[model samples]
Target: MLIELRPGTSAEAAEEVAARAGAHEDVTAWPVRLAGRVFVVVSGDESLAHVPASPAVLARRPTPDGHWLVRRDSGVAPREVTIGPPLSGPPEAPRQVGVVGGPRLWWAAGPCALESTEDAVETALTVRAQGAHALRAGLSKTRSSPYHFPGRGLRGLEALAEIRRAAAIPVITEVCDPREVAAVAEVADCLQVDGRQLDNRPLLAELGAQRRPVLLMRGPRASLDDWLRAAEFVFTRGNSAVVLCAGATGTPQQPGFGAITALRARTELPVIFDPSHSTRSASLVAPAALAASAYGADGLLIESCTKPERLYRPGDAAHMFPPESLADLVATCERVRDSARSLEVSC
Candidate 1:
């Protein structure tokens, strides 16, 4: 069990929370501080009812999956994770699911990896003009095959920083290794964890400690409960700014649109879709993206490039769509969202 004290909780209140929790037989309580927030973690097999009836207590919840993210979806509090010092933040508070102006479909379009400084900048600018909220500039990639071209390392991070500067928009990038979390957090407005890295407790804990907004992709074989439990890997440490990313499931033919709908009914955290990854085909991405929105995805991370065919890894073009198509899809998503809202409002 974890007891969350309100933000700016005083030391006395924290100690009191710990002391009261400690008084429970067979349970040990400790004070924890992370991501600039304070909370008490009670370790035991059973829940306690002796919680002090004080205003200092913000919430008390059980971490049944050994994680304490079991909060109500509608109880999301307003918070912001500053991207970085140099780059600008989102136009508005992001990660707020299903809000006015549409779903939290903060569009992010870019190549799977950084090709060149010039190409990254151009793609970022084009996507921003196409109504994207951020640029998906990956600094490092974990390829499936050993012979495939792995991404540029530190150079990629530097290039991404330059992309954010030139494009003047927030950047989202992947952190493949735990050791590089600090460096990646400094450059990326939001940190991304690949579906392959869902069980990387070390990496997720580091990201949680780094205190940046994280976009955690759902593992292909993991259940919805597994997905939320993985998110607890971050939330329990302190950072509350998390967005659940739904990707390809076990089947090759279908996207995780069903997971998106089910997750919508389960958690309040912003749920987004990665059509480019789910379908792995430029042609299939368009329909998959629309279906994700219709199924209640809060945002999207669409793979795009300046001219994908000209990429160093030409085979990557199979999954990347052009920026013009991204613009068309963005506009169409608005209309689709409007229609869905109308039906809900009337019914």
Candidate 2:
């Protein structure tokens, strides 16, 4: 069950409640202030039979969705993560290219990893020209097998910073370890917690305390219920700037995106789609991306290599797209979105 304390509730009051609930050996309690509300999520003792009575309590509700805080019923306003400077801002003024999200569709595109400084910067420039809002690169890849590329590790962060400067574009990357959080934040406009790190509470907490918005990808096996609960871990620390990435259903070929509906229905966070990663086939990426856009995804994340032949991956030709194709995909998505709005207006 979840308990929400009224506004202006003292920190001590929440602490006292946690202390009281924690006294119960079978139960654990932690207080979080997220989205301007103070909530205490107590696991184990769902009935709150032994909880101390207090005036701070504003509401008490059962958590059927794993974590009550993320449910739409919590009344948290929907959050749209704004990245980069506003698009209309002067391009020559500090940065050359910038992106924004909320009422507008934004795209983030780049290769899966920073193979080198030159390649990374080159890819960023290509995507920026193609209207990419942010550059997505992997500094440290938490892939399933250690045998595969481990990315450039911390060295790639230096390249990422350079990419931000040379390309004049915002950088989005992942931090696999909690220790890497501080360093990663120095270069990343947005931090990502991949499926492998979905349950890493410490990393989530570390990211939650930072200023950058977090892009959390749903694990292959995670249900909407599980995904929402995982998001709470980040929200618990203070920052609620979280964007959920609905991923595939384990199988790379299947590209299951049906959960977008459930995610939209449950959480207020802006939900995006990663059809490129979901399908793992370049031929299917555009179609899947277009399909997701029609479903009203707040943003699209895709893998694109300017020179696909040189990119090292298991399925280069099958999975990686060139910059031109993604630009076309974005343009097509915008046209479709505009048409849909017009239809609604006409009706």
Candidate 3:
């Protein structure tokens, strides 16, 4: 059970409430000042109503899965409570990679959209040789224009599956509709939800229910709080295998790398930056990717192709780099990652 003390409740009063409620001293009176409340963890069997009702008591709620939602008393309508366990305290090992406790940088690189099995496999092979750990391509894209190469649909998915098996690399694809969730999950090692579908409850719910690792891209205009809430939707549905992909939105005004910093300060989720989409220029991808690495990104999602001049639909003309250039970019990013790791060790 978790009890939320009223506003302005002194530390002594909080301690007295915890003592009366028989809460374990070691685990009581956890102060969450950001939410403007102090939470006291008591025994499951303890009833908070038995405590004397006073001005100090604001609300009592059961902690569900070690999380609580306490209401604030400021507006006519209660605003959505954003309180939860501290997720930004320190850098922790991510569950997706199953590593112990060191800085691990994941490199995912491939074409922006799947054109054919041959193209995906060739690109995957090139990226793998360049030290990329995973292959990413959009089987189904959410484009601004309906006629602008909406993707090859099921055939593209089949091609991506073949690329995974033939190239011996993990594949990631975007899922635009709820109906395609299961099908995409069956073939993709990880499912991606584009920024356009951030508010798509049905699609988000389906992804959550599928329980597959998800790459959640922040919407172009979405605030930091909105992104966190979007993640919360998936978290509450029991899908904790989420990787935050920043700067993959469709909007022209890039949120910049600073958004990544803000995100890291708010959550402990693994973050991957999409520099190709952010800058929308092939020449700028390397600098943006290196900046992302310097800013403590867990990984990068780069768009690389065998031939950048001849790109498929939904592919940004200025964003795709050739395989040779991709190899060079990967080497540079590796150096940055190594330097960042050394800095972390020294600190």
lDDT of 2 by residue, 25-126 (tens): 888887878767887767675654346688888887676756666666666634667765442222432253333347677779988777867877888889
Of 1 and 3, the candidate ahead on TM-score is 1
RMSD of each: 4.8, 3.9, 11.4
Residue 27, candidate 1: C-alpha displacement in angstroms: 9.2
Q: Please give each candidate's TM-score.
A: 0.82, 0.86, 0.69
What's the distance in Å from true for residue 119, model 3? 1.3
TM-score rank, highest first?
2, 1, 3
Point out the higher-scoring one by TM-score: 1 or 2: 2
lDDT of 1 by residue, 1-347 (tens): 77878999988888888888778687777666655667787766455536777788888866666644534432432223333333334343233122211334567889988877898889988987787778887777777787776778676876777788788767788888999998877667788888888889899879878667888888788878777777777775567778778888885546878887676556666778899988889998888888877776677889999878777765788988879778789778767766775776431
> Which candidate's lDDT is highest?
2
lDDT of 2 at 95: 57
lDDT order of candidates, top first: 2, 1, 3
lDDT of each: 0.74, 0.76, 0.66
Tell how far residue 246 is off in model 2, in angstroms.
2.0
Q: Over the full model, what C-alpha lDDT does candidate 1 score relative to the true structure?
A: 0.74
Q: TM-score for model 1?
A: 0.82
Pull out the clashing pairs in model 2. 282-318
Q: Give the TM-score of candidate 2.
A: 0.86
